[model samples]
Target chain A: MASTRSGTARRQYGVAALFTAPFFLLFGVFTLAPIGYGGWLSLHREQTDGLGLGGEPQQVFVGLDNFAQALTNTRFLGGFLTVGVYCAVYIPVMVAVAMVLALLLDSAYARAKRFFQLALYLPNIVPGLIAAMIWLYLYTPGLSPVVDLLDSVGVPFSLGSDAGAVGAVANLAIWEHTGYNVIIFFAALQAIPREVIEAATVDGAGGVRVAWSVKAPMIRGAVVIAVLFTVIGAMQLFTEPFILMDAATTINDSWTPSMYIYTLTRSYNLGGAAAASLILTVVLAAASFVVTRFSRKGATP
Target chain B: MSDVSTLTRPAAEAAPPAVTAPERRDRRGVPPLLSKGIVNGILLAATLWTVLPLTWLVISATKNYADLYQTGGFELARIRLWDNLVHLFTFGDGLYLEWLRNSLLYAGVGAAVSALISVMAGYAFDKFRFPGKERWFGLVLVGVLVPSAVTTVPLYLMASDLGMTNSFWGVFLPGLASPFGVYLGRVFSAAYVPDELLEATRVDGAGELRSFAQVAFPLLRPAFATLFLFGFTGGWNSFFLPLLMLSDHHLYPVSLGIFTWKESLAADSEIFYPLVMTGALVAIVPLVIAFFSLQRYWKAGLTAGAVK
Candidate 1:
């Protein structure tokens, strides 16, 4: 009897593992394994001698030296500052436009809400790389009719300038993501109880007033979530910058944290790359935590 | 599940479902309705702003290389969209077609396998009681928050160690493990699968897998749609991982192909601009159709994520 019971237990375990094995196996090797390995890599640096081709890179354990370098590097930090400014301008503009567009769609006069919703959300479905390429074409001098039109009108504009590049990059992101946020916000708005809105209207509340006090409060969770996703995404901006890097000469190797990591890794300095990513990961994670916790606590009941 | 949460709302989170009391109606009141025509006009204007770029893109695609520049931008004068496509497909011995083919393989198979794995794992996690589940799941949640792009180099290093870099499997394998998909599956299981039904199935001689396939999977259609859309979009849009893993131009996806085009275009600015425009227009077609079809799933998915 004991042997039979043990065999049944073993069989159950085997079956369970078999069912979940694919995800667990892949997750372990590709995701979990790298995270652990990245931390280890962060603690060591390579010492290459002479021409660096004839000799192998010697691995020397360097504690906190990478962190030291990252902290002290003003040029590296400029990447952070550049994106920070980008987000400071980008998020508000995008989210505000998204919310307003959603609200307009949510309004009764939007006869074809479904059509408009599809139109707004469609841009987001296009791959960022493709969208960037298309926009790059538009931003091109002779090929860009928008530029040609502006030039024809005597308002010549080049978006590749350092002054305009941040805005240009932000515009690409906005075009790709505003539709996504609009979809989320519109869902939030639609989720608002119609009867409640009707009641607010019956109570003499104007459209703007109802939006500010009633509809807005109800959709606070959606707003917070939209902002959080945007923040995390903006901080880790990659595709547009990668696609547009050549368009702007002023942008450096480390135009963002992820870009910095890419630079370090591509140069075969995996240790420093690992350290930079770790720092970026920790900072972004902390930001997510603070955003969620603070918003949850401060959310209107 | 979709309508229950939205069609009827509990008075409060702590309150049990009671008869509709209709308490505390907003007593303040609304302003008179604006002219309905004016409201529709404003909405129409917004719609134009929303879709004009895409419209211009389509129109510009039809324009030939000569007409593209000769006749100003965003016009109907240069109707060579078909010509532009020919150039795009013929460029560098037909690389664009390869990119399109690669994209389909990555997005289609990766998304299907992903949906299957995510649904099963999510169902198991939700319905089964096991040790170490919560810890493993928490780790997965962390994985979701950290952008996969952030791990590209590490993934590269690890893949290189195994000689998988520069291979198609390198791109396909990592996509199968998605934390967000698992979470969505869990949510779907919670929303769809009921304990009483599971108990009945178990009592009626259905084994666990049998019960799940016959009983739970059908009810998880919304979850499947959500996962499929997410995975498809992800697999389709994925650039950084593929960019890192694969180097051969033959193996390149459209994103990388476009990148190469951009680099060449930078070197020599010429009529390839029309090709790029037409290609961009063509590339976006399937995605736009995907939106129209999958748009409903997004609203439901977002509302679900928001509520919990």
Candidate 2:
């Protein structure tokens, strides 16, 4: 009997291991190992011995010097500022647009809600690189009807300028993200107890007022989730600016922090790139933690 | 019921009910017709914002090279969609077809395997009472928190060290380990697969793996479908990792291929412009169709990922 029990226990472990091996194996090798090696690489730099042109370089320990260098480098610092301006422009406009659309759909008077939802979400199906390329043509001076319309209307629009580059990238980002977030916000809005909304309506609250004071506050969790994910997505801003760099002259290679890290790898500065990657990760994780904490606090009360 | 209530009520009181309608309309401080117009007009504009670029892409694909720059986006003149498609397909000996095939192989195979692996791991975590189970799950949660873009460079460096760069394995293998999918898988497992059914199978003397295959997996089909659709879209949309991993133009995904063509537009706009416009349209069609068709799964997937 004891032998049979042991056999059953061993079989259980075997089956469990068999089921989970692929995920653990891939995650360990690809995700965990890279992170560990990245930490190791972040602390080391290549150095030449005496008159070294032909010999292979040695890996010398640099400690936190790479992080310090990344922090102080103007181009790298400028990348953060560029992303800062982008988030500043992007997050509010995107959340507002998505929230407004979600509210409109939730409104009693809105017709064909599913059609509006599906149409709004159509762009989210387009890949980011493709979306950026589509907008690139639209940002181009002569080929774009939008550009032509703005020109004919006596509005100066130049994709070559820095503001134009930022706006162009923001437009593409908003176009892709707004609808998906509208879905998120709409789901949250739907989860609200209808009685609460009815009660608010009975208290002389109008449609816009209920959307503001009642619905938005009730779905604060979804709003925070949306904001957190948007912030994370903003941190990984690469595709749009990278594609836009071809059309927008003011956009540099190191336009965003991720772009900066990519440029570092392209230049074979693995240590600096790893350090920048870690820095960005730590910052993003910390930001996520704070937002989660804030959301938790808001939830409790 | 309305007719019965009206018959039960006095005629004078019933007649006064119509006056309440205008008062109820005044409660919102705006007439219903005007507000409906305002709400749906804004929605229409927002939909247009989301959709006009796609419309432009569809329209621009039909224009020839000269007409692309000369004509407006919606202008219909000398439609050469077939000519442009021929150029796109036959360009550089059908490079676009190779890209389309590569994208399918990467996204299709990567998403299916990734979803299966995630479900398996999630099932094990839920079913087995292993020591350090929560610790193992925490590691996956950590993976979820750390964004993939942060890990792309280091993965690239390691892949290069393994002499795997510029190959399909370089891009394909890294995408398979989606920690977020695993997290979702766990949530789905708990929601979908009931333990009693597995216990009943155990009582029937079936082996654990066999029981899971026959009983649990079928029950978890919706979860698998959800994960697959999300993974498929994610794999199709991935840009940064593939961009860094593949240098061979033949191995480039459709997105990267379109990007390269557009990047060279300054040097040779005449040949590449219409090809890119047409290529963009072709690349987006399959994913759009898939999204609209299986939207039920994706909508559930989106809210599931966010709500938790």
Candidate 3:
């Protein structure tokens, strides 16, 4: 028994070893190490006296202060609130629009699906900076064709105020991401067994009946996946707001935990930065786990 | 092919073919006009929404601030493109070009090498046997869930400890290790590689590397293309690490460079708005080209890295 076990072990070891290397080494150095080290760094704060300069800042262990501070910080609070509101508005619109597009691509009248798929999905591939630039140009005074069209029609419009910033940013995200989700949903829609649809048609069901009764159930997992990724991403929402900083002026520095960390790091508060990062790490991990648990459940059933 | 249309096309597409065919015969057989009209209208609107802002990027990249402010965006006018290119390539000691180069290098080399490493590792993991295999596989899965953003500060500290901070390597070296690649390699090997082939090669006395190179590697081209494209995109799009690691403008990647440009503009100065716009547009070209040409690989790539 032992010998057989040893032989099987050796075989598995040799085969698996080769397959895991490139990823393992990279994952270890670039990924796992940083996470472990970040945890360690978060346990201590650099003690600084008046001016926080002219004297050496000593790293001293002060358990939980940094985490507590980060948690209670008003800006962090506001940032979280802002992003939560943003996600509330962003996720449903993006996902619903994507599903609708995916359904359209799946429909009969649409020609050149490859063209539409590529076109719809193209915005996703555009770098965030470029996407921001394009949107920012449209949002800026006199540079906006929409504003011009609005002026030509004499309709009052503005994308500058607090009420408008989230919507404007959300609009960019919708443009960038809807196509991506649409493809996923479209693929799911594609993966639906044709026999099922044919059966529905034979049963005298119209397209709406087929979609609501049969198609929707089958694509639920994909919808969940789209939602999961969007949610995970929505939780981290940084680049959009970061680039739109000009418009988000009333947005304040700690518009999100990420921004908060950026601010702390910029202020040269390494300890605080480390602590805030650690807190974010924990929150994100917890959130990701919950998403994964539900998504896996969704994927399987 | 027939199934393709029925499965993937949007719902209002539901009406078009039926409508046209029924029209040829009679109006009695057509589905409701509202469903078709609503679906097409909404879909076209959505597609337009997706396309418009990005369209502005190309047009904005070509125009000067004068045209931009005057018209507020996009002219078919063939002006300022050369001037924008020249300025973007030469501005402030030509740092924008350096960032672009850094991004290309990071994406090109980092992804290529990482793909090779993942293929080898994945192939081995699937085909060969070693100790602690399950443990290692589990570790990789955990690593997959771990976002790189969480590791930025720790990584920066580690780099500073190694005296690698502010160097191009500081930005690029870490990119070479991708947990996702290894897992993907594993998935590809499992799905595509036949154990019998490996056994046959062994029977013929091909060594491990020889079997992988001559037999297994050929089977992995699709997977490699997928891995390379994904790895390249991720590397190119990465920003936080560069922000944390490099202070000197010369060492920046396009993502970090744009952020810095944003910050500079925020410093209440006249700012390099046009140059930044031009630079942002230039930064997207490589990704756009990569996606258009490599889209086939992209679908396969997503399955391995993101989906399954």
* Predicted model with the maximum TM-score: 2
Worst 10 residues of 2 chain A by lDDT: A1-10
Ranking by lDDT: 2, 1, 3
Tens digit of lDDT per residue, candidate 3, span B94-130? 8887887888898888888888887887777677767
- The digit string of per-residue lDDT tens for model 2 on B31-108 reads 569899999899999888788888898999998778887888777878899999999999999999999998887887
Which parts of model 3 are misplaced by more than 4 Å?
A1-19, A48-55, A147-160, A292-301, B1-41, B92-94, B262-271, B303-308
Predicted structure with the largest lDDT when compared to the true one:
2
Q: Give chain A TM for each model in order.
A: 0.88, 0.91, 0.87
* Model 1, span A31-52: residue lDDT tens: 8878888888788898876785
DockQ of each: 0.44, 0.45, 0.42
Q: What is the per-residue lDDT of model 3 for residues A79-185, given as tens digits with 9 covering 90 to 100?
A: 77887788889988888777767778888766567878888888877776667766766776566887678778976456656767788788888888888777777
Task: Give candidate 1 misplaced runs (Cα > 4 Å).
Answer: A1-16, A48-54, A141-157, B1-42, B267-271
DockQ, candidate 1, comes to 0.44
The per-candidate count of clashes, in order, stands at 13, 0, 42
Model 1 lDDT per residue over B147-266, tens place: 665567788988887898888888888888887787778888898999899878866767778888899999887888878878888888888888778888888877777766767765
Pick by lDDT: 1 or 2, better one? 2
Could you give the candidate ranking by TM-score, starting with the highest?
2, 1, 3
How many times do residue backbones clash in model 1? 13
